[model samples]
Target: MGKAIELNQVDTIYEGEKIPSLKNITLHVDKGEFIAVIGPNGAGKTTLLETIMGLLESKRGEVKVLGKQLNGNGSNIRKLVGYVPQEYSIDDLTPFLVSDVVLMGRYGKIGLLKPITKNDKTVAKKMMEYLGISELSNRPIGKLSGGQAQKVMIARSLAKEPEIILMDEPFSNLDFEARREVSEKLTHLHKTKNMTFVIVIHDIASIPKVCNRVIVMDSGKIVADGKKEDILKPELLEMGYKGIAC
Candidate 1:
């Protein structure tokens, strides 16, 4: 399979910081691969996702997605890659309803000036239903609970009909039952849609069963990358958690 994402000796540094948040990172994700990126806090897991989505430009080296360079074509590339960021600050009085927020995801594909078509609404509705949030379509987004809001974000990402999905701590706000339900839905989507996924999750137990590969990061670098079975070995995990790269 072709690579869906590639980072070659990449170094991403935030402004005003001397040290790069991501250091000498080299990785490749094959199309349709379901991957779990696990690491401790400050391990650069979030940075990796943002860098791949081209939200943060690499200070050195090359970053490519779907065979295109990220430097010159980030906006176009991002439209095909759905991203659910870790946090969003929505004012309680923002006045946007859940349905409106979800439909906003399609604005990139449908064009900002074009009217929303029947097909766009259908896609957005289906995504909300699949995510078990159809009942919240008319609810004000800022009034929803944390878990409810998270589901809306997930639905919005799915509504984009993206070829790849990058999610950061997607289940963090969910309760046990909601987490299980969402995990099952994601697994089904991965199997049926052949969409590539790169999920950064802190809880190893919550990693989806459909995830075939595991990436371990520490100190802004990839310490290990391999099959889930190999990477999840007790000894290996212990080392990885302790900041020792394999």
Candidate 2:
């Protein structure tokens, strides 16, 4: 498989901060691989995903996505990477419908000033159907539950036709059943769609079930990177998370 993402000694420091959020992190993800980035809070998992998504500027090192550098020439690369944030920050009073939100994903490809076409609407509806959220299409985004909102987010991401999708703590606030359902759907998508996925997750148990490989982070550094069986041992789990047993 071809390399989908590569990071070499990457570092990023937010303004007015003493230490960088990401410190000399080096990693690579191959095409069609499902990698779960596991760590405790403030371990730089989200920073790593944002940096790769071109949402954060790096202070040092190299980040290449789909063979293209992610510094200044990341516009095209960003198009190939779909991002599902941990939480959807929607205005409670905003009147946008679910179908409208899904169609927004195509705005990047459609460009500004041009209205959404009939074909775009058709594609968005199809994506909603694929995600099993077609019934919620006309409902307001703010009215959906966490799990339903998450499904809409997934449909929105899929509408972009991204080859690689990055999810940041996607199952954080969900119930056990919802988390399992979403994970199963994601696993199915990974297999059937040939999509490369890198998800940031705090739960260690979910890693072995959802990801083929797991990368463990601690204090903004990657402490362990290996197959799920190799990295999920008690010793490594203790290194990254406190009061946790494997």
Candidate 3:
């Protein structure tokens, strides 16, 4: 198996910002690896994930996914990569159904104007079932709880059958029980489907047990990267989290 993702001496700066949000981010993630990114607020965790997804253009260096460099062809790369942003909100009166929202994931592969296939619908429902949200398929996305909504997003990401998924704060706004459930679901996907996952999480305790590797970012730089056991040590975590138990 080859590398699933690679960042070589990459630097990305947001518009109007003098300092790059990601600095010298040279890293390689192999296929089938489950990686957890943890750090304090403003640690550039989100920035790094966005760069990998090609959502944020890099100021310098190269980001390659699935053996292709992400340049003007980001949309092509996105067809193979599923991404769940860190923040998403639904208006109270929005009429989009849960199934519709999930089916949208297929748009990256099938195109927006093209006809939807039976296989696409089947995949969307199957993903919802896998995430234990099948019963809510017909419900309005705006009506579901935060946890349920997050699950929908995950299902949507899976609906595309992506080779790799990049999720930012997948467990945010959820209670402990919801967090555990989601973590277990992700573990099942990793083991059964061999889908690579790179998740950015703020809660240290929320890091899934299946994630063997952890990458720590601080001040737009990768301060540390190692096994979960080593990087989760308070001394090492303190460098990014300031002993605050992030």
Best by lDDT: 1
Q: How many steric clashes between backbone atoms does each model show?
A: 0, 0, 0
lDDT of 3 by residue, 1-246 (tens): 899999999999999999998998999999999999988899999998888888889989989998998868478788899988888879978899999999999997787798999999999988898888999999999999988999899889888899899999988877877788878888888999899999998877788888889998999999999998888887446656322111
> Which residue pairs in candidate 1 collide?
none
Each candidate's lDDT (Cα)? 0.89, 0.82, 0.88
Residue 116 in model 2: lDDT: 88
Q: Candidate 2 on 1-246: residue-level lDDT in tens?
A: 789999999998888898999999999999999998988888988889988998888889998998888757467667788888875687777799999989987775666568989988898998888878899988999888877888888778778878899988777766776676677777778889889999888865554265788898889999999987677777556766432121
After superposition, which runs of candidate 1 have C-alpha atoms over 4 Å from their true positions? 71-73, 235-246
Better of 1 and 3 by lDDT: 1
Q: What's the ranking of the predictions by lDDT, best on top?
A: 1, 3, 2
Model 3, runs deviating above 4 Å: 235-246
Q: Give the per-residue Cα lDDT of candidate 2 at 162.
A: 83
TM per model?
0.93, 0.89, 0.92
